[model samples]
Target: MTDDDLIARLEQQERDLLFSRFDFADAWRLGSLLVEMATERGLPVAIDIRRGPQQLFHAALAGSTPDNDAWIERKARVVERFGNSSYLVGRRLAAGGRELDASLGVDPARFAAHGGAFPVRVEAAGVVGVVTVSGLPQAEDHALVVEAIERFR
Candidate 1:
């Protein structure tokens, strides 16, 4: 599909994935769901859930490495900074014939506009957290997180 088409789908995902409330227990359930899915599929994924600056849940499955953790942080930063799924942000930039760069005021070091990170948006509280996964291909990484959230909420 085209970048615009992908962006539209991601927008719909963000809108549909909203939560009424999110807390530590909710974080545990969501994170655990992702973990179970990965384990069932034997997906070597690292999952992370965060509320603002505080990390709530983290897991590294077999074959997952520290690099996956780093990727999670970068992708989550993209969600926190842009208030959109990391994949959506990247697609929007590409559709505009742009990318992450100094001119865009986005630091590649700290923020990666790649798939894998999704915002944990609470309708009443706005975007209060991020859910991220890494290890698979970028889009699959994104789809994994999205699927978990869709199941959780």
Candidate 2:
């Protein structure tokens, strides 16, 4: 898809993925659903669900390496910092001809403006957490999380 198309998709995802209420149970269900989808598709990935600084669920599927876990952390940081999907942030940066690490002074080690991490918004509460995946291409990773959230919701 074109960058503009991706940007629009991410924006719509951020709006449609909201939860009326999210607790530990919801986190567990969402995390499990993501894992199942990846496994069924034979996608190696690391998944993470977090609220603020608190990690609610995390899993590294078979074939996922330490690097994938690191990507999850960095991408999650992007969502936490911007209160938006990492893909949206990355697309916005690209649209402006800016790089997340360079123009924003964000440490590359701590933040990544890429697909895969998405804000977990609660209705009327704004973003309460993040759900992240790493292993596939950036867009695929983002799509996986989006699909799982849609199913879970």
Candidate 3:
């Protein structure tokens, strides 16, 4: 087969794996577990764990602010619009200095709203989801999700 055929086959395989078996409950459970672990690790965090249109769980640890909720909402909207947490990274890499904004839909401003989201895939639960955190610095918010992924693993 040609290289195009190989690439198409691989892409199909990835899509099959990505959409296989997943939902809100799994996302919620993993998100809650992450929050619990982060608290145990002494990392103050705000978590919004979701799958599709449903929010399975959320927690704003002590010291996390109300504004964290807004950030989480914006981040969630961004991912929902763009279909991935890495949209912000993509927008940042775009040469025009454009960004993504939830308020502006999935346009060039997407980076502004999607700066703090991380995707999580749970094999056991058969779910692909996202864990969003805010209130902390953007890098820290991203780090918390990474830490959660590590702990979940």
Residue 67 in model 2: shift from native, Å? 0.7
What are the per-residue Cα lDDT tens digits for candidate 2 across 95-148?
888888845868887899889999999999999999999999998999999999
How would you encode candidate 3's per-residue C-alpha lDDT over 48-68 as one tens digit per residue? 877766677888888777877
* Whole-model Cα lDDT of every candidate shown, in order: 0.93, 0.91, 0.59
- The candidate with the higher lDDT, 2 or 3, is 2
Tens digits of per-residue lDDT for model 1 on 22-116? 99999999999999999999999999999999999999999999999999999999999889999999989888988887887878988899999
> Residue 144 of model 2: what lDDT?
94
TM-score of each: 0.97, 0.95, 0.65
Q: At residue 148, what lDDT does model 3 achieve?
A: 61
Query: In candidate 2, where is summed lDDT lowest over 10 consecutive residues?
Result: 100-109
Model 3 misplaced regions, further than 4 Å: 1-20, 90-95, 101-111, 120-128
User: Candidate 2: what lDDT?
Assistant: 0.91
Please tell me which predicted candidate would have the highest lDDT against the true structure: 1
- Total clashes, candidate 3? 9
Q: Each prediction's Cα RMSD?
A: 0.8, 1.1, 7.4
Which rank order by TM-score, best down to worst? 1, 2, 3
